[model samples]
Target: MSLKSIAAKLFAGVIYKKTQKWATNPVETQQRVFEGLIRKAATTSFGNDHNFGSIKNHSDFVSRVPIRDYEALKPYVDQVIKGDENILWPGKPLYFAKTSGTTSGAKYIPLTKESMPYHIEAARDAILHYIHETGNADFADGKMIFLQGSPELEEKNGIKLGRLSGIVAHFVPAYLQRNRLPSLKTNCIEDWETKVDAIVEETIDQDMTVISGIPSWVQMYFEKLKARSGKTVGNLFPNFNLFIYGGVNYEPYRAMFEKLIGRKVDSIELFPASEGFFAYQDSQKDKGMLLLLNSGIFYEFVKADEFFSENPKRYTIGEVELGVNYALIISTNAGLWAYNIGDTVQFTSLKPYRVIVSGRIKHFISAFGEHVIGKEVEQALRDAMEDSDAVVTEFTVAPQINPSADLPYHEWLIEFEQEPNDLAAFSNAIDASMRKQNVYYDDLITGKVLRKLVVTPVPKGGFERYMKAVGKLGGQNKLPRLSNDRTIADQL
Candidate 1:
């Protein structure tokens, strides 16, 4: 083994042991994080406003600080944008992770000097955990590519601003610098298709072993490589054994990926965002990512079903239960206090606090009171695709509240890479799966309040074309698995 690989294995061992210390005492670790966040930020303007100084415990904290989404938090963010210091966190934020907002135009999530390291650390530890568990550090000796956004940043009020992935690019560990691929110039190319072409040209002959990105963007790169080289990804890069992905569930894309790569490869699922790095898949055998309790964030959860109700009770990490979907709320060293990041997650293992991203809090179909979520839809699709010839590239579900000839129903806009022999049968299978999972949907169907779902097959590259048209073709952008309205459905 190379010196770097040997050192990596050693480091992975050390990191794994350290992680186990906190993972084993998850609730206690979270309490420490909570206290630390509150203590550290107590003197800030937000803290003063929220009575952080007088807060004695979780109850006090929750009572004082109401959960605020980006819109509600914008006044403070606006102050920070105008060069205000000691508003959110102490002093100034190091950078602003610029993200696309739904109602708001642009959200500038603060990345403080204190909190930024955790983002880099969480990503690194995920790899380390993989290395430690599998005893495979050989990938460290080969080229690694993270298909991501431009590293370029814009200056605003003395703080750098860019996509979170772009900001993270600047923090790649020095040891891995030589192995990282897609030249900085290529990455800076504004157009995604052009950037993928550039990336393919750059990494085609390299010894690529580790590839990371949102699955959809990585799929684009993989497809590009297949087209150019006329070889399966596995054949092209024989050592490419580890695929790291986040932002969306990989199960939906697994079949397509297996076909493209021509084999099954080990994969890691990460739960990362601009707000914080919450969790990462710690074991290949496990179903969920291990929640990072010792990270510089305090977590709170409101049951997903009751999230919209007046004064929904927020539960601490200690109080959450397995199998119950909860809208994740967080307070962090980055100065977000009781911030609702809009993601819903379910605990799969509470012994060490492991969770699976269930859905977006706002991204759901409830037009007819059938509150179908992203996880359910994704699961339904996966169930339908199993033991079938269907291979989906991408899909989204939206309620069809009105129809020309039948009762309203769910419309599944799907872009299939390989269509099944019987479209009606495939649609029926999806509907059945959906009905099995969601009782409300099943009731609606059985009572004739709604018809079975209709599948609208999007033409080849239709979703890509739609994304490009909407100016969100690449990087961390992903299609919502399901939406309440037909905004995306109408466009598709």
Candidate 2:
């Protein structure tokens, strides 16, 4: 056997054994992971102050540390930014994963020597587990293109700061680096258009097997490739089989990808955020991702409806009920204590503890009591596009709470690459889809309290212009699919 094939087989075997153990008894696995995290962080100042050493079980830990979001943990993160040792983690973090901040211009999430493995190894095993399940070993034999942020990391207070994908690039296995593209020089180019141009030039003739990145940016790459080569993706890269994606719901983009490639390829979805690697799609037949219970992170869930309440009841892994929407709470080796990452999820399976990402807490609309979320809106749009033979390049939804006209409505700003022949029919299809998905919206329409959703076809490049103005044009920065207010709508 080839060296790569041999390595793939052995790696997959080991990961399968580990996953089998956790699948058999996730409760036991989670308890062990929780205790290990506590023991590891107990010596740190944040942990010591919270009395982590005295915490013997889940209840004790929960009673001591209150749930917090980015704003609440900013003080400690500030200390870490100033090179304070043992502030959150055991020591000064090696780097900080900079993300779009709500209050500030950016959020610097700590990445330590201890916590880095969770990001790197989990990503590796995500691919390994897929190979094990499908008996696909030939993927490693060809090149893999990872569309990511600038590989050039910025320095602050003697620590590195950059996108998480760029930081993870430094840890790519030496052997695998040989099969990865584009060159470090090309990746470091900050401008998205320039970077995509460079990538197309560098990889046009390569024998590619895997492509990984956020869906939007990757779509840009695929489009550029098609424009340059005058061929479908399946024809250009005959060996290409795996497309690994995350950072946004892929449902809206799925149809576009299938149309672009001319044939469907294998896909794996992951839940890797700036905070940590949480879960990955382990089985193609399974609808939800298998929660990474043993990845040096302790999981907690708070009912999404109660997340903003004064005292939201927190549930451990064993306590979470299937099919209920919950905002995730996490404590990790990175020393983030009981932090809420803002994304909401619903447990689909309790036996192996799998979950479907429902939406973001801030990316929901209840302006008129419809309580519509990102997932529903994306699905509705996808169904509408499918029925009308239209394709959306980018889109966002915002509630127009006060209209100069008689009724308020939800407005969708869509940039379509292929516009539908019958625009009104397409709009009506979307309205019907939304009514089917949301009972509250249907009721409001029936009662004449709210008008049907308004679809505005923005000229090409409109969404891109908006993202560029916000300085988040590419690399893990996606347009929030839904908004509760008109801030985004006004800007668009």
Candidate 3:
């Protein structure tokens, strides 16, 4: 280890001890945090923003404004980027987190300094809580490898700046970020280029004690790691104690990766987007993680039974019900009130407030999670089709999860300008694409639920019909993947 890393670890040891002492008294720690949250609210402009200042009456707020969807808060995000100090916590506006939406180009979400801490705290607490629960306490003892997006931050005057992901590395406990991946080629940003080869080369020998990243990305890395390095990730990071994932469903890839690792690597699901880290898996091997940054977020939930046009009943942390798949709504410390993040979730139970990610209310694919959405599915199709030597001229996948005797699937109706000669290989390539893009789909294939993603070839002019009918295709948005299924992406 470098001298800087060793010294930082020594200092972290002190901080970790203090944190341990504080964590033992959960009630006291939270009460102080609660007080801090209150002070944070009371001193500022919650009342002006109609944000939760002192949710003295949770029921009162519940009755006043029902739960909201992402559209409900786009105006607030607008206010945030405008540098509304009272709302966005008074600072220079950082880069907006670009997220996909049905109605617009990537949503450039404003990330404020005040609210960004919540994401970091959630990530830290998830690891810490995992250690405490697992009886392996002192989470900082081992190396943690995060397959995070590389910095897209712009640099000027020898200083780099960017979004939440960039900020995450910029603020990483100092000991962690500088540790190179042992290979010259390391992590590449999630973009058009493939950095899998480089990362696989670097990581095969390292003792990566903890691994964190999106399930799909991790799965892809695992595949590349095994192929390029002649070692499974399990053999590579044999000392790894945890595999924390965010961004997508991990259950499908669970058995695959776990088997490769030789033992069940502890997994934690983190609910984080470009906007924030909303929740995390609390207990190791358990289904859910306790919400870490509750103090930073003014919590609210939209009852699934409630209609969007109707007011959404908001909830405080105390009022949140467990086990029901209610949509998560939040107003954070930095600024955002009654915001709908578009991601949907339901609680597995209450008391400790364990929850599950139901799915994106906006993003969906219904035929048993074969429901693909937006560019993700399209890219998969492109990769698969091209790889299979089947050139796709136009295609559209619609939710066909409805009851059908033949088969229920997120049906992909394709219109090829020229029918590829190798039809069977093309079909197999599409299957491979789906499997790779969604590990859950791969699990289903291996588990033998459905044969493959049902692809029905349409005429060459199929997507043109959609574009002509809708007047546009994929600039801001496209057709819905899940509408009537109500499973969101969770059914997969």
Candidate 4:
């Protein structure tokens, strides 16, 4: 066997067994991870202040360290930025992962030595698990291209600042680097469009077998590849077998991606954020991703419906119920304690602790008390385009709370690559689908409390232009799908 195949098999043998044990005893694994993180960081300022030494279990830890978001964590992060050691994690962080800042201004997330491995290892385990189940290991012999951010980092104080993917790119092992595409020089190109062109030029003739990236950017690369090669992705790279994606759901982009590739490829969905590497899709038949219980991160869940309450109930992995949407809270080895990552998820399987990312806590439309979410909007769009020729390149929805003349409504700005033959019918189809999916929306429409959802067809490349203008055109930069106010709507 080749070196690549041997490494993959050896890696899979270990992680697959760990995953099975994790599935069988997730509670034990989580408890051990949480206690270990607490004990390891007990000497840090935040940990000392929170009395980590006195904390015995999850309940004690929860009581000691109150939940916080970015704003509350900024002071400690600021100290780290100023070259303070042991401010959060032990010693100083190597780099700070800058968020896309689509909803707000850019925020810097710290990455420590203890935590960086989780990001890299989670990705490896995702692919390893796929191989374990499917017996498809031949792809390891060929190259894999990861569409990530620039590897060149900027130093702030003593810490570096760059995208998470860019930060991780620096640590690609020597063995894997040989089979990875896009030379190190090309990866340092700051501009996303320019970098993609360079990547296409570099990898056009390589023996590539695996592709990993956010769906939208990968789609852009595929389009450019097709344009140059005059063939589908499958024809261009016949050995391609795996497509690993995250950051956004692949449902809306499924049809377009299938068309670009010209064949169905095995896919694995991962739930990774600036806060932590959380979960990944393990089974093709299973819809939800298996939560990583031993990834040096402690998981907590606050019921989504009660998240805004004065005292929201928090549940651990041992307490979470299947089918309920819960806002995710995480405490990590990187010194984040009960940090709300602003993402919501629903448990689909309790046995293995599988979850589906429901939506963002802040990215929801409830202006008129009708709660609509990213999932609903995506599903509504999927249903709307099922019978039509419409293909969405990008979209965002916002509330028109007080229009000059018309009643209050949700305005949808959709950029379509292929327009539907009947535009009015497409609009009606979207309106009908929303009503069918959401009873509250249906009730509001029936009572004439809100006008029909307004559909505005944006010119091709409108959203991409907007992202580029905002300096967020590349890795992990996702457009917010829903907003409670007219901020997004007016901007569009």
Tens-digit lDDT track of model 4 for 55-95:
99877877788888888888888788788899888998878
Model 2: CA > 4 A from native? none
Where does candidate 4 clash, by residue pair? none
lDDT of each: 0.93, 0.88, 0.56, 0.87
Q: Supply candidate 3's per-residue lDDT for 151.
A: 50
Worst 10 residues of 1 by lDDT: 397-406
Which pairs of residues have clashing backbones in candidate 1?
A: none
Off by over 4 Å in 1: none
> For model 2, what is the alpha-carbon lDDT of residue 228?
98
Error of 4 at 336 (Å): 0.4
Error of 4 at 110 (Å): 1.8
TM-score of 3: 0.64
In the range 284-319, model 3's lDDT, one tens digit per residue, is: 666764554334565566764352545555554555
| Model 4 CA lDDT for position 351 | 82
**Which candidate achieves the best lDDT against the true structure?**
1
Indicate the TM-score of model 2.
Answer: 0.96
lDDT of 1 by residue, 16-54 (tens): 999989889888888899888889989999989988899
Taking all chains together, the TM-score of candidate 4 against the true structure is 0.95
TM-score of 1: 0.99
Q: Mind giving the per-residue lDDT tens digits that candidate 2 earns over 1-492?
A: 578888898889998998888778888888998988888888888888899889999889888999999899999999999888998888789899998898866899998888898899888888998988898989898999889988678999999999998899899989898899999999899898899899999988999999999888888889999999999888999999999998888888887887788899999999999898999988888968989998888899999878889978999998999878899999988878899999999888987888989899878999988889877888788888877778888899998878899888889988887888998888888889899988999999999999998889899878888889988888778889888888877988
